[model samples]
Target: MGKPPLSGIRVVEFAGIGPGPFAGMMLADHGAEVIRIDRTRPGGLSLAIDAKDPLLRSRRSVSLDLKNPDAIAAVRRIVRDADAIIEGFRPGVMERLGLGPDVLLGDNPRLVYGRMTGWGQTGPRAHEPGHDINYVALSGVLHALGRAGEKPTPPINLAGDFGGGAMFLAFGMLAALLHAQRTGEGQVVDAAMTEGSSVLMSMMWGFRAMGRWRDERGTNLLDTAAHFYDTYETSDGKYVSLGAIEPQFYAEFRRVAGLDDAKWDRQMDQGGWPALKDELTALFRTRSRDEWVALFEGHDICFAPVLGFDEARADPHNVARGAFVEAGGVSQPAPAPRYSVSDTVVPQMAGARDDAGLLRELGFGDAEIAALGH
Candidate 1:
């Protein structure tokens, strides 16, 4: 790929699960030179692993024990030239390693320090350990999901982890990088998953405050409470999602579904949602998912089949848009945003580029390279 947007950017990533690795991958995907510091035991290969985590791709890995003073010092040295340093751990982990943002920025005044935690850097729960589900639950996003009477369904790790942690961390780092570019000064971005998840609810919060949305589960317009917007099971035991909001779109949806005057008249009425959902479900079940898809294919009803990961890779629309690409015999979704002049890449392999090659390109001397000896 000819020079990506982040081609000249340098990032140092402290190895972490889910969100941290994902953030690193995003930066690397855009052509940032990302170096992942792994503390895992050396020498391991696994056939069970997916290799297409959508997280570990497009980066270089250096195994180092952060507990080691030399290793900590080495990390600082790496950050000395980095545009940004991102770490995801409980509150004190990096500070305990002696490579905290305060110390690193003291050394590299132009460095942007990005921190990701489940809670935050200074909240009462900051030092506590929690995962994506907990953060989302606390933020009320989880409760907003699922059927009206059903328990909240975890949307995997997407909401709190990727949406909150990785996305926010990437945004923070990039914003800080821009600031550093203009002023030659750096700043630290404290990105808490809780904070990000709350930010995600901004529109909902406004709705609730204005009495336009409800707190009850699955009752709000966006929460699948409306007949015009929700998922319905299909004949093949799979499903299809409908989001035919707005008067005209819902009118098209009504016409497509053969809705009568009663259904059309009270489309947005709170009292009619259950009847509407039942009617839609019955109509949807009469035909296969593909049949329904074909029926609504060209309309602006915001219709989509609820395709799984494998199905998505082979979908015609996705294929046409080049949304998924195969690399190293593995197929996964590609990096986003079609640039007019720049290239966006999917990292074909995790830890593929040589560490030695990256170091040399970054201007590391032989002695400096040698000092990172295992």
Candidate 2:
């Protein structure tokens, strides 16, 4: 295979936290030369507790004191050769530092300026401080996460921080890069976690519009309401998930689960779901998760054991597909969305190489690199 699709792309990432580094990681994973401009000390926007955090993988780091005029000038010089720049900061922070879009883009019109934020650039809450939970809360995501009578459960930081913020920032940068490549005009990509969360609920919105979904939590088709589309605890305290949504799949599931009773015949009776779920709960509890897996392994039933991270990594199917790989002494998820013609590499832990040598490759002279590093 040839080099990764983004092999020749160059990115300059201003280290902040959360989604910014993740975006840069994605760029680097796909063969972009992502150079992270890290700070000398922890400040208001520090993202990682340790400099060796895995999210900073597949990149080189250059520590700079943005408050210093010389460092700021050096960053500008670096940006002149970059295809894109990523930063996750509150509005006007970059402008105040003299590295804002107008300043950088003035010198390099083809630069894709990617900005990551929880509330976006011009919202009423843009200036306020927030995190993943806060951002998803504003989008009704948190409210729809738990059981109908229970308090909403947060899905950690995945939904907002990585899903909404980081993924969107990466996508926006790629799209803007395409535009820059064609038009020679770069623009700011204001990726907001709140808006991205709302976008993720698009199908839910459609269901609500069609009266197929209610506003209450955990009462929808795919939200664990249906007896055939939820996770059930086994006798061994392990769990298995079912997604026998269609009639044919449900039939196969019923046959495999021995649900041949007259009560189970009324599969679409919404009023009987609670009773059906209770019966299934008891039935699933009679067998171990592995027993159920063996019973339905090669059948048409839509079933799978609810494996933990380690178990998932070792699963036969996942192992066969090469879904994960180890690098830099850590077993991490490999780069995704495989390409038939493009090649990708395992990422290394960031900050290992000499920043001076990396800067020299960027066209900086020996003295310039030393001065920048100091």
Q: What does candidate 1 score on TM? A: 0.92
Residue 100, candidate 2: how far off, in angstroms? 0.9
Which candidate wins on TM-score?
Answer: 2
Tell how far residue 2 is off in model 2, in angstroms: 1.6
lDDT of 2: 0.87
- Where does model 1 exceed 4 Å of error? 40-52, 351-372
Clashes of each: 0, 1
Candidate 2 residue 316 C-alpha distance from true site, Å: 0.9
Per-residue lDDT of candidate 2, residues 1-374 (tens digit): 88999988999998887889888888898999998888666442323335356788888877777887878999999999899999998999999999999999998999999999999999689999999999999998888898768888999998899998899999999999999989999999999999998889999999999999989887888787888889999999999999888899999888877888889888878788889999999999999999999999998878999999999989999888788777766777888878899988677876454667777777778887666644
Q: Give me the overall lDDT of model 1.
A: 0.82
Worst 10 residues of 2 by lDDT: 42-51
TM-score, model 2 to reference:
0.96
> Each model's C-alpha lDDT?
0.82, 0.87
